[model samples]
Target: MADAPPSSEKSFLRRLTVITQPVLTRIAHGSAPFITTFALIHLTAPVMANLGGTSLASQVMLLGREYYQTPFGEKYLVLAPLVIHPLSALLKRVLAPKPARRLSSILSVTGYTTAVIVALHFYTHRVAPTDPSPPIYAVGPSELDYEYVKFGLQTWPWRSWLGYLGFTAAVAWHASEGMAIIWNTWLRSYLGGPPGTKRSRTIGAFLGGVLPVATGMFFMWREPLMVFASHADRFRAAFSMSPFYWY
Candidate 1:
């Protein structure tokens, strides 16, 4: 009689097929469209900034910047609507059951919609204010000016704060979930032994939760920290710059 496959071996095979199946499908269909979308966004940002407020190009670029910079912005703004919507739908049909597939589709759509709203909020507060004001440091690499950052914070006060909070929470949840999925698909294979399983899950959870919180804290505290640093009178006078300068 043929020997029975060990329970662990069976699990490994199931996971391996689960992971490789989607990868193969993507490869066969090609990933060029997704690549193109990212390239377009990158190429467009500077051109739009250069064009400033007068032209459509500039407006488009501003929109891109707003979408790209927000929390969970990358996934929802760029990937979900642009790439993952279709990918998730396909995956749902192929891998998930009816309810799971539906949930995945709903989440992807909801995530994308939230990103759009957040992007609009950013545009109204941050990007719109800069219009008609000569593009600050237009010739240099894109950098956030301390004044602009402060102005943004002060512009809508409560609304801005709420938006930031929502953005941060969405990002944290989405990113952590994505990481967990990837972990289960890839890392679990090599680290499947009982001794390492718990450790792996713990590490993954920590990374998923901690990274988003840290990012939110950074956004909240960054301006104050910069302002405090600017209080050195001697340094400010010598440099003819405020302590708040990003440097």
Candidate 2:
């Protein structure tokens, strides 16, 4: 067997955990509301697209994006939580005195997966189009609408279809678990009880059923032309910068 850590090292690690645990917990918990709010708005777009049409969906999305996409809101509300929550959770795990429980482990996996997917989604839609160095394309928030979404879906198996499916499922599952955590820890008194397994599973089932259907409905419509057809070359150039270019 390998030798144990020296006593001094163990003492230092214990000290570090004491210093950081509360701060990390606060960050992970405090930032959750912002993430949840954004998620609710983002998820609603697909559903509205299903019920009303792509135009309605675009309107819903734009309403939310107008605020969160602003510099201050994006920095403090969206980007910071996206980066900090996962990092805080990770640090907590590393400093933990023992292994995480099974549910916690599952949450970690889903949470990390969520961070990657959200980052990629933000970059592809928001950043790549506005990138300056190579000057691939110059679409701003006002220009991105259902047409941009339909362009992605139109590419079918090779582009974004499966990615959307996975995104919906992963986000639903992760969000359900996060809600459960909030109820159990923060709102137990007001809510009267923890979200027991039955209630949690019910929420999971509801999200799993609804979100994918919304995603499917989104794919049903077709854009009259590909995204930025008049500027196809620039669109392609910007899209090519995506890590999921071949996805």
Q: Pick by lDDT: which candidate is best?
A: 2
Worst 10 residues of 1 by lDDT: 135-144
Candidate 2 per-residue lDDT, tens place, 44-123, comes to 77777766667777888889887688889989988898888888888888877863555346577678887888888888
Pairing residues by index, what is the TM-score of model 1? Answer: 0.39
Candidate 1 structure quality by residue, lDDT tens digits, 1-247: 9999999988886786678667644542344234335535643432333333123333454567675656687666554554554454355456532333344542354345445544554454344433432322121113232333333344335544455455544434433444444455556789763323434544653454434433433343343423333322222232222222223
List residue ranges in candidate 2 displaced over 4 A. 1-9, 102-104, 133-135, 198-223, 226-228
Output the number of the TM-score-best candidate: 2
Give the poorly placed runs of model 1, Cα more than 4 Å off. Answer: 1-114, 121-146, 193-247
lDDT scores for all predictions?
0.43, 0.72
How close to the true structure is residue 135 of candidate 1, measured as C-alpha lDDT? 28
Model 2 residue pairs with clashes: 158-247, 159-247
